[model samples]
Target: MFKRLYCNNYRGLVNFEIELDELTLLLGRNGSGKTSVLDVMFALCRLLDGSAKVTDSSIFPERTLTRWQGRKEQTFELDVELDVEFDGSVQCVPFTYRLEVEHEEGGRKARINREILAANGQPLFRSDRGTVQLYRDDHSDGPMFLADWSASALARVQPGPDNRMLTRFADFMGRVIVCSLSPASFATEAAEESERLGRDATNFAAWYRHVLQENPGQVAELTSELRKVIVGLDQLSLVKAGLDVRALMVSFAEEGSKPYSLRLDEISDGQRALIALYALAKLTANQDCALFLDEPENCVALAEIQPWLMEIADSCGESLPQVVMCSHHPELIDYLGHENGILLSRGNGGVTRTSKLKDVSADGVLKLSELFACGWEQ
Candidate 1:
């Protein structure tokens, strides 16, 4: 697993490192670099696709400034170094990924400032002039490939549990995806693995039925967990084919069936949210993959965050994927135990700090909601 991650001179962040584990959460006020952190992580995912490209995108100048916006210490530099428990022992993974923008007379493209990767804390690779390598292993026989095949390529590769695990991790990003805050319309996903319905989750019903036909026990567990988090969610029923299929679809017997649709739009907003969550939890729980969910507590009753988040962790741990989430909600912290959380924040003139919940006072939970009383409303 990736044990530590550090970044420097990237957007508002100057330099930062955080210990990491399954189920990490980034929290803080707006403009506090929370989204930037996740954006960088997602960028890494996007970067791994070999065909991806970097272009100068417009972010406000005031917003573009780092923690030391007008200070001399603020050289445009981003160095990423991480520690990973590779081969039963911890090894420092070297990273020197960086970018720089020119400000002279109508600024142009952000120069490909720097890119490098080192295994065991030593520079084995670096992008200079023009190049990138995102994935590589000191111990693997095969070369990893990501579509965005330039300067950041070595990062495209990571050590998976086995060859299969490694391949699955690199080949698919759905296992570790990010959904922007769209509490209203973010109801689904496109199926990456054929078993997966889709990100929009258009095939939720199909996938659910398939799982039931193949993995009934898991489906049952999912139903139970969903019931706990959703107030009126009664037992969910899927009609098996070769028998009964129509006039029912997947019925929430616990609630009024009320005729479901392809989009499952007939249900209450909360039900749709919970259904999406539960479906994802079930799909990802058994597999050893990772998922990055931001503001997972959205749209649900405040009281259910704890139980739902716990179920998410338990379900993910049960599956093959390791899960990490970011939230601005306190109830999430209240519900998720310390072991399940790694608190993420930016401090000290924009230095990012990552610490475990267990490290905090009294069971390691800091009552995060109250801490962000004014900053979370947006």
Candidate 2:
């Protein structure tokens, strides 16, 4: 899991460090930049995987400067500590990936100023736009030139004796999953199996079907878990649509009545949202990845949200991907407990600030949620 994130001059983030746990919940009012925190991580993943196009015209970073403070040339530094199987043994290591970007020629272009990767506080590789250097076990491989300033040299470089850190970092970054739940995709007709769960779960039906096929008995387990919260939900099955079309269908029944079935759209939006999240949690239960959910309480019923989150929390074990969720729901804040809650609030200057609930002193009289409701400040 990610240990800490230090972001400087990135959008609403102005030199802030967020301490993370296995399951961190981002809490703030609307427009407080809670989602921006998650987006920064997503942007880094894209950059490490060679998918980010850093420029004045790009969708990400909308602007290089922090709007309120008028700061420019963002620097993102991240620390991730995880255990990996290395040399036939399990070893825990701390890895840091730092990236710095600057605008050139009066905002006409954006370029990378520096990129550095380190392990256990030792520099493994460091590069500037002009020259790239590789260090292995504390030895430098001299300076190597880069052809393109826009592309990431670390992402494009292949794994060799000297640069296994780059390979490991790239592999981890490639698998980080950031998603905001989608009900439309859940209700759509199946096309084919998905490569991975899309950002908005646009391929949910296909991915669900793929998981059912690849891991037999997994669907049955998911159905059993869903039945606990959604009392009437008996099972989730696939049905043939018009002609050769296929879609996911859910079946429900009263205590002594015949069962009825509904397609994704036929059900309430809240139901579809819960079902999609349930399937994703079950599908990724045993994988190594990072899952980020943005405002998961959007369509979910208030009463059911607690149980739904509890179920997801139960499914995520130590070896599985860690989950980070952004939510403003008071019940969600209560469910996360005081230790896991990170408060994000915009101050007078429109700059966002982050604080842990434990760090804030309370009277020991009010519940965590109550404290959050009353402005979190004494």
Candidate 3:
């Protein structure tokens, strides 16, 4: 799981650093850079995946850079620490990835000036204008030149027995899940099935079907939990729709009554949102990774908020996935108390600042909800 992150000169953030817990909650007003933080993280994922293009798409090579507005030679950097299991043991690996880009003529394109990767404060690789070098095994092998420049050198390097640390980092990055779900999308049929839940939850029913096929007993557990909060949500099933269509349909029945079934769209938006989130939690319950959620409380009802929070917490287990959720919900803050709440604010000349509620609440007397409700920013 990701333990800490430091981002510099990225979008609305100038310099940001925060330590993440098992279930870290980003709480503050909107536009304080909460979504920007997650977007940057997602951009980093795309960068490492070698999927970003040069100045063509939303992720990279110039779209993700902080708008310089004609400022000279701005750079974007991130220092991330992850505790990952490798060779049957867990280790905390720190990676410092930086990119230097210069805007081309007319601001339509950005060219890479420099890109570097350092692990545990030791330089492992560097790329200058697309030419790359790998400092193998702590530089004992000197710098071996690699040919890739359009992608991250760290992702390009093939890890051997000597560079198992790099392999672990790659594996951890592959498992990172960033979800920003849309309930409407959940009803749509997927073009192709996914091994894991999609960020938008477009393949939710297909993924849930896969989950149930792998472990049939999980439905009983899911139904038990859903029934507790949803009153009549006794069972869930995936049924065929038309020729090749499949959908997640819920069954509702009270004691001594015939059960009724409804498709996802037939249900209220709040119910659909809750069901998708619950399915996501269950699908990722046993995985060890980082899950970044953008405003999970969207479309959820006020009465079901507490139960939904509890269900999400329980799905994360005692440790795993290191959930980082962005929300402005007071109930969520109140339920998380103080330790898990990381407050974000735009201060100090329009830079996004961060501080944990644990630090803001003196004497530990006020609940996090009350602290925010009482205008803690003032």
Q: Could you say which candidate leads in TM-score?
A: 2
Writing each residue's lDDT as its tens digit, candidate 1 over 62-135 gives 23445355532212322333344556776544444333322322333333344554444444444443453333
Error of 3 at 124 (Å): 4.2
Ranking by TM-score: 2, 3, 1
> How far out, in Å, is residue 194 in model 1?
9.9
Specify the highest-lDDT model's number: 2
What C-alpha lDDT values do all the predictions have?
A: 0.50, 0.74, 0.69
> Clashes in candidate 1: how many?
50
TM-scores of all predicted structures: 0.62, 0.84, 0.82
Residues 1-378, model 2: lDDT tens digits: 788898888766777788888888888777777777877877777667777666624324436477676545778888997665666787777899888887654566777778888888887778787367777634456446664666567777777765665577777887787777777545467866654566677677877777787666567767887897687998888787767567888899759889998887788878888887777677666657788888777788878787777776775555355888898677887788576888888776777888776777767787777876777542
Point out the worst 10-residue segment of candidate 1 by lDDT.
Answer: 71-80
Two-way TM-score contest, 1 vs 2, winner: 2
- 1 or 2, which is superior by lDDT? 2
